[model samples]
Target: MDYNLMREFADSWGLLAMALFFVGCVAFALRPGGRRQADEAARIPLKDD
Candidate 1:
């Protein structure tokens, strides 16, 4: 493929793909009951075992 074609595809589709992925991650993080899991993970370093 030519450089111009590849660059055009990446400039549009690549940006859309990255934006969707970021939104999905934010949704997952903010979902119900996520807070408890996040808190437990935060305390992992303090655990002895």
Candidate 2:
């Protein structure tokens, strides 16, 4: 395995992929109806199993 080549690829493509994934997650979290889902999840720990 070539460490320098891998580092270059990660510095380019890996960073782009991470940025896209982060944006997608933020968009999903902010979408309509997300608050309702999040509220429901917030109650799970207090609910009877």
Candidate 3:
């Protein structure tokens, strides 16, 4: 509950958690077969209902 403890947790675990999340997102975006889904999503706004 103290500032020092919170700061240390943020500097260590928080950084690790954020890094892992970013890497997971990058992996998902770059994975095989994702291009087709991405292209479809990109054209959603231009599609008529």
TM-scores of the candidates in the order shown:
0.92, 0.88, 0.96
Q: Report the alpha-carbon TM-score of model 1 versus the true structure.
A: 0.92
Report every candidate's CA lDDT.
0.99, 0.99, 1.00
lDDT tens digits, residue span 6-28, model 2: 99999999999999999999999
Per candidate, the number of residue pairs that clash is 0, 0, 0
Cα deviation in Å at residue 32, candidate 3?
A: 0.9
Best by TM-score: 3
* Candidate 1 vs candidate 3, lDDT winner: 3
Of candidates 3 and 1, the better by TM-score? 3
RMSD to native, candidate 2: 1.2
Could you tell me how far off, in angstroms, the CA of residue 47 lies in candidate 1 after the best superposition? 0.6
- Model 1, 2-47: lDDT tens digits are 9999999999999999999999999999999999999999999999
lDDT at residue 25 of model 1 (Cα atoms): 100
Q: What stretches of model 2 exceed 4 Å from their correct place?
A: none
lDDT for residue 1 in candidate 2, whole number 0-100: 72
- Clash list (residue pairs), candidate 1: none
lDDT against true structure, model 2: 0.99
